[model samples]
Structure formats: structure tokens, C-alpha cells
Target chain A: MNFDDTPEQARLRAEVRQFLAAHHDELAHGDGAYLEEPGHERVDELRRTQAVLFDAGYMGLTWPEEYGGGGGTNAQQAVINEELHRARVAGPVGHVGLGMCGPTILRHGSEDQKQRYIRRLLRADDMWCQLFSEPGGGSDLAALRTKATRHDDGWHVQGQKVWTTLAQHCRFGILLARTNPEAARHRGLTMFVIDMEAPGVTVRPLRQMNGHHSFNEVFLDDVVIADSERLGDVDDGWRVALTTLMNERMAVGGGGGELGVRSDVLVSHANRLLPRLSEERRVLAVEALGRVLVESLAARYSGYRLQTTLEKGEHPGPESSAGKLTAVRVAHATADLGLRLLGEDAVLARSRDGDWRWASAAASTPGIALAGGTDEILRNIVGERVLGLPPDRPRTPAAATATPIAESR
Target chain B: MDFDIDDEQRNFAQHARDFFSEQAGPEHARTLLAAPGEAAPGRRVLAELGFSSLTIPEDFGGVGAELLNMALVAEQAGRQLAGPSLTTAARVAVLLADDADRLAAFSEGRLSLAVLDGPPSGSRPSMDVVGATHFLALDGDDLVIGEGRVTLGEPIDATRGLGYVELTSSEVVAQDAQARWARARQVACVILAAEGLGAADRAVEIGLEYAKTRETFGRQIGAYQAVKHRLVDDWVAVNQLRSLVWWAAWAADHAPDQLPIAASAAKAYCAGTFETACETLIHVLGGIGFTWEHDAHLYWRRAKVDRLLLGDESEHLAAVATCTLHAADAAATGELQPI
Candidate 1:
């Protein structure tokens, strides 16, 4: 298997290197991919940085040129991501819009939706959040009770969605709601692009154990939506959602650099920290290092394999989901090990007095496992799709009997 | 750039599986063990199939192929638990190729070296030594090929016997013994790791197949998330195992400088994967898996034997850490030469 970069790809990588070198000072701090900051400020910073990347033609290199993308290949995208990962750039913006929502819209959105959303999303003009999982719907996502009864004007939506990442900053969302109660579980839903600022819409931040607020519970109390906002046909939301979900796997699977952090960094950290640790803890650290290294190498190359397939103009399919599964585990485990190795200073968000600031800052890593898809869901997908195993029994969803959300927790 | 083997290797693997399945496989392992210590039939098939000469150069009367082709044979052997590895001779033959007589004899299928499990133990046990004229051992940094004075014992895995070879009068095959040891060790790692991958693949298949029929709580076990997730993870591990095996085997032939770390990583990873998979196969097989009569133990036996055969998982992982981290640290400091 040849993984050598083509000359053109090498040239592009050099260009990206030069770009990052030039912008190193400005990008040394946070990229704000999370939602801890004010929505307006986050959006502003994202727009500015994204505008620079857009002008540099590094944004959406793999997307077709019609959507303001560079119309390059997945290899280019992989190179760009590798550079971005090396630079440790997070952002005040969410990648969901560009990676998931935008692609789904481009494939399924009406002409108006495509023209209105693709360019803006690519330019990071507006952050987007997904409103698919409801308070009652996680693993059994199709059993969501969010109702979108038909209105004379359009549809009046009433639902509460949980784990709505970036909803506090999002101007728009792809919302899934039950449109036909009489239809089968997966056949009765519809997808809509709801304005987060629409009347009766509310977003309440969910502060996590990481002490960060990256997720939100969104309440839709009779939120009115125009029929034009609908994505795909009525009762065809499952197909549209499938596109987003598949793209979500690709995004997460091929996400950043495989290991979130480099082995050199971990090695250097060990070289620095091991001297001060006790014998028992030193052994523990080595064990963790072994796990981290195995996972990092696997994830890094798995991502490359996915890119190879993507460069061949094929979707990553079920195999790529393993990347996300492995990555989320690695990211969280490394973070946990970092905090434990921090001795007494683990309570603080990070150390200004020490070197594991990045690791300590990984407090937010647990969120990654749930985002895109839960670990169990991904495992099931890998089992059923990749291994050709039988799907879980098609029993009715446990949440199918839940009462409609009354702004429930 | 593809991460998969070429179509030729894939086809060869199918042929190997077909041949071994028909003649010598896990079933063959049992039948062969009934006669214990009689490795003639297996050795004969290997010679006829040219498996023993896969790595020897054409000048020495061999197929003169690379480790990738050898890996296909090893993988199919592991998949079916088919006989002892003939890749052993192919490995040491390439390393000791300067010994023209030994190389010629091995290439002509008249000579073989029973490779030993060279842990730090003083009394190391050799394997597959039934009809071999010489025994090879790696003692510390020394590469010794023994000629006389051997002690035999019952093997942990009955398919192969164990023996101790005296190295005091053995030949020093190379002046740079450490270098030779490292080279042969990496190539051997490739072949064995591929076998581990095959075993893992087979374990996953066995588990999934059993899960489809074995019922618990009035439902097929495969329908349960507990069983299904374990099999899924096993499948994932098998994929990782294959990837690493391919990389190691590829590196052994094309990137020798990178082979040390690649092979160590493959060994470290595969050793664990194979053991875990074989254990899981027994778990999935339930009561019968524990019975000596069931075939599950044979795979488990081979997996356990293969793991500790070269070096245990921990030892290999230590090597992985040393080789990889040192290389990484060197690259970071601009000390490493380009691969």
C-alpha cells in the first residue's frame, strides 16, 4: 500500500506549512471549536479565521468548486487537516456545518438551500448545529417524539433536543421531527432547517463534568417553520439523516491527526514527568503510554486508509467508524491519564506553572465519544455493516412511549 | 495508495487456504498430533509447495520471493492452524545466506534449523526440531547455530516439541551478530504476526458462526449486544492486526531500516490480539471450548504457543517502545537518517 504523497500533494503540503508558519503567532492560542465563549465573539473570530483560510484556498479543498471550495482531492483535505492538527488549532466554530450539514444539504438541499447555505457555511459566516437527537432519542434516534404537525402556513414544531452542540451559536439547524405518527418508526419523520432565533425556540447550555458548555438542550415550543425550510420530502427524513450520519462518521473518522496529539509530545511529557512520579505511577504511565501508542498508530493509519478510499471517490463506509471509536477512546484516556499524573493539581483547569496544559485542557474529550455518534452505536454499525452480522432485534424503541417534552431536562 | 495487499497475494492466500483446508489444517493438526513428533508429512508438503525456499535467492535454487509472499503462507497456516511454520528456515536462511553450504542445503530442501524461543532464559527451548540437523538460538546479542548436544522436552503446544541446543561449540554465523539477530528477528516477526492475524480472523469467524447458532435466554447469542460487541471488537482487532502485518511484511522486503520498529510493533500488537481472540473463541464456544476434544483448544494452543514462541507481548511491546520512541526522538532532534 503506497502512502507516499504525490508531488502535487507535497507542493500543497509545503504551501500549507508556509501558511501555518506565517499565521503561527495569531493561531498559537485557542481555535474556539468549542462553545465556551460568547456566541457573537465566537462567531466573529471563526468568521475572521475562516475567511483567511478561505482566501488561502485551504477551506473545503475537497468540496466541488461550485460551492466555493478548492475542488481538490481528499489527499489535499487530509494534508490540510494534518497541518491543522499539527498546529493544534481548535475554533470558536463548529465543523458540523461544513463537514456534515453542508454536505447533506449539497446532496439533498433544495437549490435555494444550497445557494444560501453552502458558501456561508464554508466561509464560516454562520455556525450550524444539528437538532436530531431528542431528550428521548439517543441510541434509539428514530423513536424521537418531536412533533411537527402541519400548519396552514407551514409546520409548527414542538420538541426538545439534547446534546445540541453549538446550538447556542448556531443561526440554523437541521431538525428532525415526527411528521406522521401513523407511519412506521423510521418512515414518519421529516428534516427541516430551523432558524435557531425563530420565535418559541430556546437553547439552554448543558454544563458538563469537563466544566465546559459545548452541549445544549434546545426547546422547541410550537416553533413555526415555513415549508420552504424543509429538507428532502416529508416522511423522508431518515434518508436525509442517513446522509448526515454517514458524513458524521467520515468527519469523525478522518478527524484531525489520528491521535489528537503526537507521540513526540507524549514521549517528551513522559521524559519530563516520569522522573517525579513514584515507581507504581511510573509503571502506570508506561502502561498508558503503550495503550496510547497502539491507539495512535492505529488511528493515524486508519484515517489514512479512509482517505485513500475517499481519494478513490468512495465513502469511508463502515470501516472508518472504527477511527472515531478508537480516537474518542484515546483522546479521553490520554486526558484522564494526564489529570491523574498531574498529582494534586488536577482540580485546576490547566497548569500555567507546568507543561501539560494541552492535556489538562483535554477535559472536554469525553464529549467527543457522544458527539457524531455514541460508542455503542458505532460498534453496532461496525458489526452489522462491516462484519455483515445480523442487526439487533427490531424491537420497539424504549423511548417510543415517552411523553412529549415539556422543556424536560 | 492502497492499504490492502495486491490482488496476486490475495489470490495466493485463497489458494493457500484451499490447499491447507483440503489436506492439512486445524483438523490435520489433531491428526498429526496423534502421531506426535512425526513432522514428515507436513515437511514434505512444504517442500513440494516450495514453502521452505520462499525467501532463498534464485542463485540458491529457491522461489526467491519477499516477506510479503511468505506472509501469505504464514497467515493461511495460522488460519487453519496448519502444521509447523516452514517460514522459519526461510528466515534464518536469508540471514545466514553467506554460509553457502547451509544455504544450498536449505534451498534444496535438505536442511532445516529448528528456531528456538530465545527469551532471556539460559535454557531456551527449540521448536519444530523433529528432522532438523541444526538448531538456531539468539542468546543476548549472539546468533548461534548449534550442531550437537541437545536436550529434549515435552512442548507446551503438542504440535511442536521443545529442545535445548548447546551453543558453546555452535558457529558464529556473522561477525555483527546483533545486526544479524535483529534482521532475522524482524523477518520472523512478520511471518508470525501474519499468522496471528490469520488466527484472529479465524477466531472472529468462529465466534460469529457460533453466535449465530448458540442460544442463550431463548435468543441466539449473536443477537445480544455483549456477544455482538465482543465479536465486533475482535473483527476490528483483526483488521488492525492485518494492517500491521502487511506493513511489517512490506517493510521487511522494501524498507529494512524501518523493519525493526515495524516488526516489533506488529509482534507487540499481534501477540496480544491473537491471545485475546483465542481466549474469546473459547468464551464463545462455551463448555465445549474447555473440553480437550473440542477443536477450540487447538487454536488456543497455537495462539498461546505463537505468542510466547518468539517473545511474550510485554517483551515485544518493550522493544516497540524502545525502537519507535528512539526513532521518534531522533527524528524530532534531526538525528535520524531518512528511511
Candidate 2:
């Protein structure tokens, strides 16, 4: 009910704002705009910037100090994120590694495993991707058919992972492979920290409709991983994956980007079209304006609620699915409105003066909807978890097992 | 920090459910609907149960409870699809609680009241407000409480008239004009929002159960992509509505300064969400949901009436805009923090 930050929280916010302000000029002058572009050069630049953040004690603010983190609360981390987002600085490119994989490893990885990877991940010396979903087991991940047979002093992994973001740039990955087909689908799986550069492993970039290679298809063929790389006990991979997935949900649900876009952009679009718009078109434009206002307010309130929840030490729950769904819906709706407001000019993808950059950004709406999880999958989560609806009937074991990994790979 | 209700609130909600289940059971509600004209016995039952006295101040010989408490009972009434006249009676009691004299009459079961009018253009009464000892009229800027002769809509029995009260004021019981209008609007918003919340809750419960049990294509209809998506959307809407309602109730209870903004947000969000939830539930239920014998229509009717109770969607939207603009102006002038 209380929306204002506490005194201590307010001080922390001020500190974060100060830090962002100090770094703002440097970031704005450097390869900041290139952060959203998909390229290895930008990834490398981001890694260097992440190291600077870590050196300044801002990276891993919510993580325990034993793992090369600041050992701060989630609220502090959220404040850091909000400030960084406000400053338009590119966030740590190792988000998947630090936020999800590293956290899972901290919970379940061996001491040696943590010692070797945690510091490197924080420093951005190494990048990571998730090798969980296969061609056949995206949503139904328990049905994965990836196999990792035992080998001398190690394990031989043979599988393909698809839709892995920045896999081509990753030095390591958290891989899920079936170690025992005799056990139940969930029980037989195991998690490992696989070296992406190991023999017989290949990563091919997959260009999305937006012409970005932000994701890739990873092929693991007889990729040998040391025993030290195993994340948890054999056949406990599903539990480890659960930890990563939970973090993934929170990270995705954490509202990012500009909290609210500039109203002037919208006003300018309307002003440019007001004279040309027909009477009916003007009416539609006004209605769209009303919708934009309501939706923007809704999104802000939702973000505020989430910020409050984080401040209270609650990890994002199934209710986070609502935020995810609303975010995508609002984005899509806003983008559509922008397109309509821009008339024929909106169809053009590129303009020499960047006048249509907003429209071009809107063009990536579908990709955003499908990125973290499909809109449909998010709905299922909301229904089953948030609403306490009954779980979907279990797919038959035979049919589930029959799914081919190649399709996902 | 606490998302779940406390033990006291939980017990209060449970007691409310029990009271309605016992007193306003399916058969009881059916009887009320079939006989909307009768007011004496129903009013007596409500007064004996202390429902009508909920909002009255303790000095007036009534239960002095917050609007939140009233909202709880209203929600339960909604779940049972209780008759609108009874709801209107509760609303009137809430409105009259601010006036010591009216509260005294309501506490004594001497004030039989109802909201009997429709929108501006409608000639006939949309709700049963007959046989009231006093009728409260909410004009644009005035509240006129008067004793009047009313037309009965149908026969609930001899003592009640399912009818509208045609105002024939012999005396002005209370007149605050602007203040009365604001109070009436707040009460209307709370009651209507609570009703919508109730309907949305029931629709979700029924839809989820049906999704689990009803099979199609060798799996529960809920297992289908189309149905699952729709059900999930309804779930989201329900959550949003719940949040807005609680915030609204809290504002109405403690922060009257924020009441205008909070109440409009609550009503607008609830109206839209409840309408969608009801429609989606019907679709999820498929052909069985469309039948007259099904209970879905009860919720649909309640949602429709609640949506229209206090200025429909557009009216609420305008209210939202006005409040938002005021907040913006205050923020600009450094009178309030920008939210």
C-alpha cells in the first residue's frame, strides 16, 4: 500500500543515480547505441564495459560476495537496474550467465565449479548461454532426448540446442542432457557446465526476421565435459534447470528499457498527421491516444507493484506472468498505434535521419513476444500457477519420448 | 509486504460467505428474483442479520465498519447472484449512514429504501425500489431524501412492490447537495466494483473447473491452445481487477484524498475485466454455457447491471481522465509527487 521508498532505500536510489550520472557521458559517447545491434564487436565492447562496472563494485550487486558479488539485497540490485536503464547504458551482456546460470551454479554447483566460473562470469571474462531447450522439447522440456553418456574422467554429450541467445559468443553453457532413459523423463536428466569450445561442438548463428543474430543453434556432438563441470548430482538436472528457469522468469519479467517513452514523439506524430487525417481518421487517432494513456499508466502501475515486491524480498512469482503478458501486449499495441499514426511513412524500415527508428523498433514486436517465452506459454503459466487452475494432462510417455531433438536443435 | 489477507480479514471473508450461503442460497435468491416486489420480509432479514446497519456509526445504533467490510459482503452477494434490490438496499444504508437521523431509521428497520431508476433516457425503473419508507434521489449535484409514492413493478407478495419510487417529497430528510453526491458516487463505485469482482471470481472458478473436466479431442478443453489462452487472459484480468478493487476500497476507507482517482480506476478496470471474464467463460464452456438453465447467465446479468450502475464505461473513463489530469496538474505545481 505504501508506494514511497523508505529512507534507506531513497539513499540507495540516490547513490545509484549518482553512479549512473558519473558514467552517463562516457557511455553516451561510446558504443552505447550499438548495444542493441547483434554483432560480436558490440558484444566484446559490452564485456569490457561490464568489467568496468564490476571493478566499480556495481556488478553482481544482489549476489553473495563469496561469488565475487557485492552481497547486496534484491532491492539494491533493482535500483541499480532501474538507474542503468534510465541512463540508457547497455546492461551486462552476460545477463543469462550472471542472472540465471551463475545463480543456479551457486546453489547447486561444486565449490571448484564456482571458483572457476563465478569470478570469470562477474568480470565478463567468459560468457554463457542456456543449452536446455532442444528441437522437440521447447515447452515440454522434460521430454528432451539429448544424451550424455559416461566417459573416462568426463562425459560425452551429443545434442543440439536451439534458440540460445548469443551462443556464438559464449565460452561456456549450462547444458541439460538425458543420462538415463530407464528413469522417468524428469528424473533421468542431468545438468552440466559444458565448455562451448570443446571438441565437436559447433554454434551457428540464426538470423531472426529482424535480421539480428541474437540467437543461435548450438550443436554438441561427442562434446567431452570434465566431471568437475557437472552442476549437481546425476539425475538431479531437472532441479538445477528449475532454478535457472525461475531466475529466467524473473529476469524476463523485470521491466526494462525506457520506463516511459517521450510524449513528444507521440505528439509530433499526431501533429504531422492532424492536417492530413480525415474526420474518421482523426476520431480514431484520438481514441488511440486515449488507449495509449490508459495503457501507459497501467504499465507504470504494474512496474511499481513489481518494484515494491522486489523491495519486499519476494522473487517474482506466477504473477510475474501477468507483467510479461501486459508488457508485450502494450508494446504491440503501442507499436501498432505508432504505425497507424505514421500512415504510409511507417512502412519504411530505414530512414537516413532516423525519423522512422521508432517504427522500425516497433517492427520487432513479434520477436519480443516470442523471445523470453511465447505469449501463449506465458498465459498457460498465469492460468496454472497464478489462477490455481488444474495442470494440463500429462502427455503419454511414449509419445513424449518419441519427439525428435533435431527439430528443436 | 503481505499479499495474503490477515487472519481477521480471512475470517471476516469466510463469515460473509457463510452468511450468504445460509441466508441467500440459490433457492432464496430465486425467490427474491421471482418476487422482487416484496420488501418487508427481506428488509427484516437484512436488518436482523445487521447487514443494513454495517456502515452506520456506533452512536446511531448500528455496526460501525469501514467500507472494506461492506465490500466483502457485497462481493459474497455477487457470488450468489443475489437480487439487485437487496444490493440497492445495502447501498442506500451506506449512503444514509452519513446522516444520523437516516441511520437511526435504518437501524430500526423503519427505512425501506431502494435505487429504482435507470439511465437518463429510461422511463421505467431498472431495479425494484418499491415499498421504501424513504427514497434517496441522486441528481447531478444534489441528493434529495424524501418520502414518496412509488409504482410497483411486480408482486413479490402484499408487503412489497417490485417497483420504482416516484418522488413526492413531503420533507427534506437531508440535503448536502455536493457532499451528498460525492458520497453517493463513492458508495456506488464500491458496491458496483465489488459486484464485478464477485462475478469475475465466479466466472474464473467455473471456467477453470469446466476446463479441467470437459473433454474434447481426447483432452480437457483447457488443454487446447485456444481455450488455455483465453482462460489465462481472463485470469490476468481478474488479478488486475482484484488489485484495483482493494486499492479503491483502501482509498475509500482511509485516504479520501485519493478516493476520486482510485475509485474511477477501480470501477473502470473492474467493469471492463468483469465483462470480458463473463464473456470468455461462456465461450470456454461452449454450447452448455449458452443454455438458460446454466448459472452463467446469472453472473452475466449481474456484471451487466454493475457495469451500468454508475455511469457506464465511458463515464468512468472520463472520471479517470479528470482525476489523472488533476494529479498531473498538482505534480506540475509541486503540490504532489508525480506517480
Clash counts for the predictions, in order: 6, 8
- Per-residue accuracy of model 2 over A217-310 as CA lDDT, tens digit each: 9988888988888889998898898888777766664442221223324444555555688888776675565455445445445566666667
Top-DockQ structure, candidate number: 1
Residue-by-residue lDDT tens digits, candidate 1, A32-82: 233244356655666677767777887888777876878887778778877
> Candidate 1: where are CA atoms >4 Å away?
A28-47, A254-263, A278-284, A344-352, A355-362, A394-409, B38-41, B117-123, B138-142, B167-169, B337-339
Tens digit of per-residue lDDT, candidate 1, span B193-280 = 8877887888889888888888877777877788888888778777777777787788877777778767877887887788888888
Best-performing candidate as measured by TM-score: 1
TM-scores of all predicted structures: 0.91, 0.81
Task: Go through the candidates in order and give each one's C-alpha lDDT.
Answer: 0.73, 0.68
Per-candidate TM-score, chain A: 0.88, 0.86
